[model samples]
Target: MGALAVVAALAVAECSGGSTGASPSAPAPSPSTASATCPSSLAPANPPAPAGAAAGAAPQVKLVVPVDTSTSTVLKPDPAQQLQCGKVQVDTKSDVAFAAPKLANGQAKQLLMDIQVPQTPGPKPLVVYVPGGGFVQDDKQGNLPLRTYAADAGFVVASIQYRVQPDGATYADSIADVKSAIRYLRAHASDYQIDPGKVGVWGDSAGGYLVAMVGVTNGDKQYDLGENLDQSSDVQAVVDKFGASDLSKLESDYDAASQQAAAGLMTVVGKYVNGPASTQPASATPATVAAANPITHIKPTDPPFVIFHGSADTLISPSQTLMLQNALKAAGVQSTRYVVEGAGHGDLSFTGDTKSALQWTSANVAAPLLDFLNQSLKG
Candidate 1:
């Protein structure tokens, strides 16, 4: 805010203001963003950041187009910005400035983020996190808890907020926002001083769907147009926790066991499911549903993945993870799948020892997530 840095929640505009949804859409495609709503001063160029920071918010001094814009920019920190997240101390390390490329017709929303670097850095690896909110809920502000954990673990994290379907915007637009954010990162890789090649992605629930979308649609190069850009939005690693993995598969079996786990499927029909939302277009046709799912795209070269789900999940089945894991393995991809025996859809707190961590989501998940990025993107 001081040097013009925009945060994920207060994803400020470039002119001067700031402020900021949705589920997975289609297999995977290049991003196409409309106009941004965040103020210019709030952008990395002339940030008019929020006055009082959220204790739970990530410490972001840099302006990352929030979600849809041009190449991403990293600002330099004043080393004096001290943020307190409950009992944790977060440093908005850098006020790296950036601007969101002007949009077309739609207003831009800020998917604010906070980045944390390692103690000794030639350049630390990056993890761009997408928070979950079943197409109609959750945001960067909601993911404060998990973000702090990632920073303390050492990777330079990017906690993002994708576009929401606030009545006017469609579901596909939300997923497109995810792909757009990645493209921005790829297009301006050097500016963030990140290993463009070694980037990793992570998310929960709806966020997981976004991560999976990128994993399967990694090779499409249509979104990038810059010269130094790799034309590849492929990530090094993926971490999906209790997400709606296979939408088509869910449609096939609306099982009683899966009823609670994958509840929203019912909301589109009758009762038995009551979430924050659900809808059948009063105007559009059935084609929209199939057009907005992420599982439709599954490829071999996408990226290695580490997915976790709660066995007790009711909003989305644990078996959903299996459907995806099998797909990746069938395509000759490597993946680590773990189920928290008795947990539910929103619980990812299962702990496992470091040695057997891959089987759990404890301290083990972070290091392996880091290792996966190193294996694929590290130079």
Candidate 2:
């Protein structure tokens, strides 16, 4: 028979229950059962014997049946097959060079970033993550769990590498590197399937401070240097995790013990800006120190911010974040601060390497961060 004629015959056989060994009086299968059996239901009831088979022998024939599904009706919708439970698979691209920044030694270095893109259908919002390392070290891959979590949640996360104090790099170089990364993402948004219009930045500790600077100095041109100048480094949302706002006032915010404990960190900060943090002769000048503070750049038109700090943090001082939050509010900006109780600086509760740890972060940090980003960017 022709293909169409065969299919029609199968359909007639199916409707009439003809010669398939199924009793005519047999009860029809339930909707779920029918749907489940639809795949195998098209198998021919009788098959031709193999070419060398004995006359009396029955042989198996695997038939490829074509079914017209356009007119098929789904008797019942499967609750298991719902969009709410759908998850986007995440793909990671590592060590992608975004910029070539000149180091203090005058040697140009390729600044790289590790990006995580979701395999979802549409262009996803972009989130540039800067890792914290006391401004002396840039641990770009330090918090993979958090970065992966953000990626799984549908954001294109680029964990970036910036110049550090050890590279003889100044604060401007680091800030410029960050802004350049943002601009690079925007410039290549189509290549990475990123929604250039919706971009956000998240950082921890010194990195947090950098993101805050990026947030506050939205349209300031000083930091917008090196390639992709056409693209804006403006971020719609900022997440600051235990980052310093005002380096000069950090010591004052801390208690005597904390000041003594974080003295070395203050020295690193001073080195970053090239003058003084809470110590003398570190590297930074008074003007440089003032300019590095995110609070110094805060305006009413800056992006919305969500600052996370641990009450038990002694390194950056939760009060520093509080100072930032208060400054943002005073400037008529939208800022939300969440204090993770009993959690220390860069705590596992915020970074999450294990399942339980991720759960804790999802509940305390990621959930709120996602909510804030969705509202600020997706809206």
Candidate 3:
């Protein structure tokens, strides 16, 4: 954790932590602290033997590219930052780093989750938020807008911070952290007043890819990093905002693009796979890259999905979302796709049905988002 630059978790001081049980009166929302008691019953029903645990837990130095945080001050904001929406309070427990047992480089990384609970609640539904940054940039703090919006919608939101590629971790490592976050919540569900059975995940960009992975690979032991092995990491619903379902597919697009465009696109996806797009699909760096695709994990049992992508997205391409949608349909899984006309990657503000200058607003996306979540999470 030394020169590794591992960001520390935040401390929510103003708000109290831990969950509460059923009560006659309104249950006030409280900040949730890490639980010391990990019940044996909460471990994965069938844990996979630690694959790379015995290897060096060191950081993949080769993949550790330099990231300039100067302009991105938002990456390292006040961990103790708090927001309030009327009687409902939004508190963030930042920098909650968990150890990824699968990492060859035993570098400990942290995750950030913002929790917001409603006043009148029993076991409230939970939504895990994963932000997008091309898998190499951005932090959980960058998800403030989405977190607050979801929190206000009455869903207990946990905006998580997972290790990006620059940290020398692969898609597998990032997914381990994502599943770990879900297990962490379920393990402490009662304390956080969470309905463990009613949980969903929403991610944008790189985060969307991880969420898609999370959705498709519900019980895959390989990605299960032995954390909370007793509890399941399956999510009930998924909101994927222009996330790449398959890196191989995205890289394949680089083939037809001009030299300059391919170079620019590789700058984003290359880091995730730890190599360049010019040498991908057939020979991506991490041999597991193809298997990492959400499409590979698709099955009819998979949870419902709401996919959002800018129809004109040139970054990851709208085709990525379409591919997954087609797979889901063939697999017979319930799915919804929102093709924002004229909208590009991550831009949810397309008011006109056909076209217009891009405008940005939470409501623009939130309307459909909230509806989807309510229909899926609220039973």
Q: Say which candidate scores most in TM-score.
A: 2
TM per candidate: 0.59, 0.72, 0.68
lDDT-best of 1 and 3: 3
Angstrom error at residue 280, model 3: 6.0
Model 3, poorest ten-residue lDDT window? Answer: 5-14
| Alpha carbon lDDT at 320, candidate 1 | 65
Please give the TM-score that candidate 3 achieves against the real structure: 0.68
Candidate numbers sorted by TM-score from highest down: 2, 3, 1
lDDT tens per residue, model 3, 1-379: 1101110000010011111111113333343543211112211122111112122222311111122222111111121232223435544444443333322345343344555554446788999888765555435544454455566667777777676654555677788888988998899888667899999999988788899999998878777775688988989999998788767555444233232333433544544565322334323555566677798889999999988775445456666777888889889998888766545554222111211112212245446777889999996
lDDT of 2: 0.65
Candidates in descending lDDT order: 2, 3, 1
Q: Per-residue lDDT for 1-379 in model 1, tens only?
A: 1111111222222112222322222122233322222121211121122323232422222211121111111122221222222232333332221212222233333333444443434555678777764444435544443455455444556666655333233444445556666666666656445666667888887788778877776765543322334345667788887666545444233334333322332333211011114343211333434434455577667678877765444445555667777777777787777655444444222111112212232333334444555565564
Worst 10 residues of 1 by lDDT: 65-74
User: Which candidate should be chosen as best, given lDDT against the real structure?
Assistant: 2
CA error at residue 167 for candidate 1, angstroms: 5.1
Between 2 and 3, whose lDDT is larger? 2
Q: After superposition, how far is residue 166 of candidate 2 from its true place, in Å?
A: 0.7
Q: Which sections of candidate 1 miss by over 4 Å?
A: 1-106, 143-146, 187-191, 221-231, 248-293, 347-361, 364-379
Pairing residues by index, what is the TM-score of model 1?
A: 0.59
